[model samples]
Target: MIEIDNISKHYVVDGVAIPAISGISLRVEAGEVFGIIGVSGAGKSTLVRTLNLLERPDSGRIRVDGSDITTLSKDQLLRYRRKTGMIFQHFNLISAKTVGENIRFPLKLAGEYTRAEMDRRVDELLDLVELGGHRDKYPAQLSGGQKQRVGIARALANHPKLLLCDEATSALDPQTTQSILSLLLDINRRFGLTIVLITHEMDVIRRICDRVAVLDRGVLVEEGVVADVLLHPQHEITRALVQESCPSATTGQRLGLSGPLFRLTFLGAVTYQPILQRISAALDVGFNIVEGVVGRIKETPYGQITVQALGDAADPARIAAAFGEHAVRCEALPS
Candidate 1:
């Protein structure tokens, strides 16, 4: 487990102090796929770097597995870094080294494995990343996805319990991104590896992350299970992220078509109800569904339907409250 308590990092540029993170705190559970999401310069990059002590925080404490890493000495910090491996967005494999050699770089640097042992581990890691046949191939010879697999293999070289992925798939195409995400999920399940993935892409988080933290301008706006956060985002930033993941979930005049707007979200038992039928039978409201989509989050029934509510009701608030009681999230839009 990792506990970041009130961590802050600052930089000096031309004699003026600039704050990157301001007293941010978060907890990453063991064997959990946790994500930190934000736009560029939201301090997400700086925060991840702080995990491995790459960007030392000016204040507060960092604890990993009950050890206060923030207070560690130089030698202690080096060992701590080895225990937490990092992967970058660019799949930073050494162009000069073969796939096998790149995977063994960390082990070589630590000087902790024997020749025979290293060879065995390299073979095992290559197979782990599903690149066993590409051991002798150089970075230039492999495709983008293949290069990232090599990067994954190399990151696991030292057998780190925690893996930090800094925008690991932001550069890939959608299909390739999904593939890489699936790989990360597999790695987490197989090794009980605790992964902290930081990205601006919400799809990456929605696909595999168990829980997520949304950061906006260095502040943690929201954090919770991916499904819950996606279905019911508490912060504006989190809502925007979720909306981006499911563009069909949007409200208002859609695709150049002008009409009244309604936002609908279904969860639990209410999701199975024929909402249109219920609305017609219970009230004298007409609906022109502008746009809608039904999607799942972790196999949980979750969806958003947008409809333009028409006609008048004797009790508008009462009807809405009744729908709300059924657990079907609903909101009316203004013209």
Candidate 2:
């Protein structure tokens, strides 16, 4: 597990110190996919760099599996760093090198392997990333997704337990993004790798992350399970991110509902149950679903549906009470 304890970082510009991140503290459990999400200038990049000590913090400690990495000696840091790996938004491959050579870069830098051993490791990584056929191909010869696969392969060359992704899929289109994200998930499942990914997009967080931390203007605003945060966003920044992913999940006058509109959040078995129909029938009322977005968060099913109650069902408390019987949560959404 990785524990960030109140770490803070600042930069000096023209003799003035500007804070890049402040009192940021969070945890990434071992073998779990943890995501840090924020918009531009939110200091997400600074925070991720600090995890690997690429950008050192001005205060506080970083503990990886109970070891304080904040104050390691140069040699200790070098040995320590070999335990972690990093991926980037751009596929940072050496342009002149072939795919196999790019994957061999890190092992060669370690200088602990003979030529034959390095070759074996390179071939292993290419196969692991399912890029065996691209061993001799240069970066220019591959598509964006293929290039990223090679980058991921290179990152695993050191056999690192932890992988840090810095806006790793931002450079790809939606379809390619899904493919890369799926590959990451497959790697995590196959090897039990701990992944710490930072992105501004919530959809990326929703898709692969187990837990997520929300950052806004360098501060940790909120943190929770992916399902909880995405289904019921608490912070304004989080809500905005949700809006981008599912615009229909929004609550307001724009929905064009004349009756009382309530936003209903359903989970697990309740999501598939006929609670809404049964309740409306029992109350002798009718409801029109204004809008909704239903999806699975990792494994759990979640839905945020907007419905307008007509006649007797318009009683907010009664409507809520009826759904309570079936464990379906309903809230009177502000318009």
Candidate 3:
């Protein structure tokens, strides 16, 4: 329901122009979770802020549903922002306000709801975020994850159609991040809210995003389905991110006992197939399976293995050819 068309933005630092985003266009479908990933200084935060016109672009248009947000008047922009919720890396809740009061702050600012309506909405959001029992507690009283739940509840107080998450789970631990991601997935399914998340973590993208766009040096380098991009990344930067995000990985150089290192990737039903056994029995080579990760990106199952061939039969090209013959994908790594 969001369309970003050829948007570019730059900043003038002491008479020198530095671009934060350049020639970027993206379409986020309704009721789907879309993720934008990049390392630091890649402008992920800047791009998400552009969705609500928080950061005005130097060139091009942003359309939400059908309205062009870029051309909206100041008052119009304020009204439009209420329909777009934004949560920050730091749980941006008022320290003095209780959880219930924080959730009701948006409605109060709009001055549209009565006291009874506000109370009902606050409780509803609290329940939605599972922070109902903490309504009376202040932000200081809650844990990191709990504070984020309050932030989420406050963002949804106005029933926003679009949600912008700027590294929402980056501040939490691994377990807390998983819980927050699960909550976001549940929220998307239940409310049919269109979500655009910005993260540097590939794990987050693989876990919940339907589609992903990779950013590097302010340029949109790669964009595609989560399963396709996460499993088989085309860009070097993306491959590095994937390797870092994997459960366990060892470099050929680190082991100091390498000859030919090949990465075998099994996709879909092939991941469930016993191709490895058949290949081992047929080929005259003995394969030493090193690093491996067998898991799902969203819902598509994939298995990737690093093989170190032993003995005089260690031909990387031949092994790759064998995998290709069986319709399995393989890549030979640098020594």
Candidate 4:
């Protein structure tokens, strides 16, 4: 639903151009959750802001469902933005407004609904975000998670076709973050809304993103399915991000295992099967797991294990072939 083509953005400081993002390009398919991840100052926020034209790129085109948003007229852009909603890291609700008013604010601004209609829509959004009982509460009276729920309810007030989340859950605790992510996922499935979110956490991407793009120093370093990128990261930056989320999966060398080490990747149904035990028994080889991680990427179960094959008869190529027959990927790792 969203296509960003060779977009570049820069800022002028002391009459010199400082790049925020350069030559970044990616796509977000309809009804999917796409995540852009990076460390601080990696231009993740800058890239996401460009989607809503909050920060217009210095060069290149941004097309949403086939229309070049970069070239839209001011009036046209205003109308376009109404169909796209944004949620922020810090809850951007009006302090004086109650939860109900905060949600009603968007509908009021759009001038597309009557007073009774806006009130009914506000109630529906409140219920959707599970804040029906807290509608009368002010921002100062709510918890961090509650405030964010209000922010989400307000973002969805106008029934946006696309949602832009800029560090939407970064400010919350782990439990709260998971709750918010679950809500976003439900929203995506229920409304078929396309979502583009930016975060510095790999765990967030693993939890909800269908695809992810890694950003580093204003460059698009890597991009792919969450399962593929998390299991076998191709870029150094991507590996580091994955390492932060699952240390054992990336730092197998630290395990201090003797003999030849191989990294085995299991996906889908194979992740649940006793592939290693079966392979070991069939080959008359003993398998010692040095380090391992088993978890799901979105809804797909996967496992990445670092193991050592024992016994003199255990040929590396032959052992790898045995695992391959069961739809497992085995790669020799440095000991």
Candidate 5:
């Protein structure tokens, strides 16, 4: 596990102090995918960099597995850094080096692996990222997604326990983005590696993150399980981010319905069940679905539906109780 304890950082320029991140504290559990999201100038990049001490915080402590990493000596820091790996948004591969050479770079730096051992590890990583055939190709010869796959292979070359992704998919198209996210998810599940990624894309978090922390202008505004934060956002920044990904999830006012409207949330098996139909019939009330979105957050299936009740007999309390019985949540919305 990783613990960030009230860390803050600032920079001085032209004799003026500008805050980058202030008193941000959070934890990342072992073997889980955690995401940090924010807009530009929100200090997301600065926060993620603090995990590996690339950007040191001016205050507070960073602990990994109960040991404070902030005060490590230079030699100790080097040894500690070997256990962590980071990938960049732009594929930071050497244009002159072959894919296999790039993957072997970290092992060569460690000075512990022999030539044969390094070769074997490189081959294994190539297969892991599905880049076996591209081993002999240079970075300039590969496509954007392929280059990222190579970068991922290189990052995993040293068998790091924690993987850091800094907007790893922002440079790819939507289709390529999905593929890269799938590969990352597969890696996380297969090896139980802890992943910490920073991105501006809500869809990226919705697809792969188990939990998320929202950052705005250098402070942590909200943090929770991916499903909770996405479905019912409490912060304005979070709602706007979710709105960009799925507008229907954020607002139901576009329908302009006359009757009472409600936003219903279904989770897991409840998403597949006909709970709304049964409740409408049993309560002698009719419902009209104004807008709906169904998808999965990581592995859990979820759905949000904006519905309008036909009769004045629809009691909000009773409706909530009925849905609650089936592990669903019913929330009343404005007309």
Candidate 6:
């Protein structure tokens, strides 16, 4: 488990002090996959780095498993870091070393095993990452996904309790990214490793994160369960991310349509309900459905549909009111 209290960070650019993160607090439970999402300059990278002391906060306390990591000495911090592993967008592997050598390098540096033990551990790590046959290949000889597998194996060489993933799948293609995410899920299930991931892609968060926190301009904008936040986002930034990730979104402005533009987000069992038909039958509202999308976030099915209410007899407000608390959203366009 990890707890971050009132954390803030500032950096000097040229001659002026620039704030990267300000008074952000978060708690990540053990064995939970936590994601931090934001656009550029949102301080997502800075926030994740602080989890492992890669970026020291100017003012705040960081606790991991009830231990205040901010108070650790240099040597103590090094020892603590062994339990917290990290992977990056770039593979960050030793170009000169083979895959097997790269995985074994960590144990060699720690001086914790004999030659036989190192060989056994390297093979086991390779097998765990499904790269056993390519262990002898160099980084240059591997594909981008293979290189990332090597990175994952190297990160896990120490049997870390927590894994920090900094845009880990940003460099891979969509198919490769999915494969890597699947491997991470397996790792979480098998090893019970707590993971903190930072990414700009909402799809990445939806695929694996148990919970997510939205950040913008170094501030915590929103945080909650993936399903709750995805279904009912409170912040504009969060909504923008979700909307951008929608597969059926249209171009240009959405608010200037002839009819009222509405975004209907379906949550829980409400997704299975035929509320749209019920509303149409009960209320004098004609629905012109535009964008309809369905996807899963953390295995929970979520859907959003954009619709336009047409004709002079339509009453959008009355239609939204029909749902009460069931399912409803209506935004009147400019006439």
lDDT of each: 0.84, 0.90, 0.90, 0.92, 0.92, 0.86
Error of 4 at 322 (Å): 0.5
Q: On a 0 to 100 scale, what is the lDDT of residue 209 in model 3?
A: 97
TM-score quality measure for candidate 1: 0.89
TM-scores for every predicted model: 0.89, 0.96, 0.90, 0.98, 0.97, 0.88
lDDT of 3 by residue, 8-53 (tens): 9999999999999999999999999999999999999999999998
- Candidate 6 lDDT, 1-335, residue by residue in tens: 89999999999999999999999999999999999999989999999998889999999999999999999999889878887889999999999999999989888987878999989988998999999899889999999999999999999988899999999999999999999999998999999999999999999988999999999999999999988787668999998998787644443274345656666777666777888888877776678887687667776666778788766757757766776557544444443
lDDT of 5 at 51: 84
Per residue, candidate 5 scores C-alpha lDDT tens digits across 213-265 of: 99999999999999999999999999999989898733345665666778899
> Given candidate 6, what's the lDDT at residue 54?
95
Q: Which whole-number lDDT from 0 to 100 does residue 328 have in model 6?
A: 49
Worst 10 residues of 3 by lDDT: 247-256
What is the full ranking by TM-score, best candidate first? 4, 5, 2, 3, 1, 6
Better of 5 and 6 by lDDT: 5
Which of candidates 1 and 5 reaches a greater lDDT? 5
Candidate 4 residue lDDT tens string, 1-335: 88899999999999999999999989999999999999999999999999989999999999998999999999999888898999999998899999999999989889989999998999899899998899889999999999999999888888899999999999999999999999999999999999999999999999999999999999999999999888889999998888898986433456666677889999998899998889889989998887789999999999998888899878999998999999999998776
The all-Cα superposition gives candidate 5 an RMSD in Å to the true structure of: 1.2
In order, how many clashes per candidate?
Answer: 0, 0, 0, 0, 0, 0
* TM-score, cand. 2: 0.96
Cα RMSD (Å) between model 4 and the true structure?
1.1
